[model samples]
Target: MATVVPPDLELFLTGWLRSNITDVDGLQVGHRTPDGYDGSYPLIVVRDDGGAQSADRVVFDRSVGVNVCGWTRNSPKDCRDLAARVYGLLTGEPDILVGFAEGSSVCAVVPDGCNGPYPVTEDAPYCRYYMTVEYSAAGIRQS
Candidate 1:
């Protein structure tokens, strides 16, 4: 019997945004936002918010969280601007193709919903904005 395997949304989105968004040079993007990450300003973090697989296992509905962080001393506008760019890219397109390991790929990505480029008070040293997006993906089947 064959089984369907879902693509890693976090990794795909991280790489996708990093390669596609060329406006911001030196922007750091990753799957996780480390504790006290002091490497650079204007960073983007991608997180897997988890999702559901269809009963037939051929489709997956996934949610991803994207965060934009800027230096605290700087105006929050920078963080907001980056967040807006990400949001536009994700939602503006009708369908996005995300390729993963071995020949496996997400055939389509549909934006279900989006929330906030809001502030993060916890990370006091940096201004942060968070956004969430839902994706409908076609998984790969393997025996």
Candidate 2:
């Protein structure tokens, strides 16, 4: 019997956005935002919101959260704009073949919903915009 390893959506998304989204050149994409990240103006963080697997464990349905952060003391327009670009890329295509790895691949990515460009009072000079996406991935088979 082969053991199955679920796909790492965070790594896949971070890399996918970095490679595909050309709108924001030099954008920093990662799994989490540092405690006091003050180095970059615009950055993106990906989170696994969790999901379930099929009875046979061959298919996985995942919920992922994508947060776009912009450092602007005055307004959240920067974050909103960046978020729009990210949303466009993710929602533009009906079926995106995320990639193939370890005999597994992300079969589909569907845009679930999007939230606002809200002010991050705790972060003070930063604003954030978020979106939720659903990813259907094929389980990896490791013998």
Candidate 3:
């Protein structure tokens, strides 16, 4: 029987977020904002600040930051509402991503979901909210 190779934590995470968050219609989600992303209101960009490896190297902990930014031409409330949705989606369940790979998904003990809407940058163009989730990836092979 061919053994099913397990996916790395980082890879699994990227895929998980893409599948979970980007599925929302009209929301542009990616690891990086799309080129010429200007005018693209309701954009979500995800970044992973890779975590420290466990002593056994079978686990890791990292912070996944999602920035929900948009052109709030008329209403900042729209942006706030979108940010709330984003927060709820991310904080729903850390276990949702645990089965991504066959016996390879990260088993999260505690997912510290979401951090900031850190001072919205209204720089004449777009309004942005920065939020971060801290999650631990257990049973993930470093290799």
Best by TM-score: 1
Q: Each prediction's Cα lDDT score?
A: 0.72, 0.71, 0.61
Across 1-143, the per-residue lDDT of candidate 3 in tens digits comes to 33223235445544655566654557766677776666456777777776666676656666777777786545566667677766665555455534444543556534455576564655546677778876666652232
lDDT of 2 by residue, 13-120 (tens): 788888766676557889998888863557889997868887888888877788888667467777777887777665444354454433335677655533433434
Candidate 3: which stretches are off by over 4 Å?
A: 1-25, 93-104, 109-113, 122-124, 139-143
**Greater-TM-score candidate between 1 and 2:** 1
Clashing pairs in 1: none
Candidate 1 residues lying further than 4 Å off, grouped into runs, are: 93-112
User: Given candidate 3, what's the lDDT at residue 85?
Assistant: 68
After superposition, which runs of candidate 2 have C-alpha atoms over 4 Å from their true positions?
23-26, 94-104, 110-123
| Prediction 2 TM-score vs. true | 0.79
RMSD of each: 3.3, 3.4, 4.8
TM-score of every candidate: 0.81, 0.79, 0.69
Better of 1 and 3 by lDDT: 1
Q: Write one digit per residue (lDDT tens) for candidate 1, span 4-117.
A: 888777777777888777778678889877787763567899987778888877888877788888766366777788888887766544353343433335544554456665
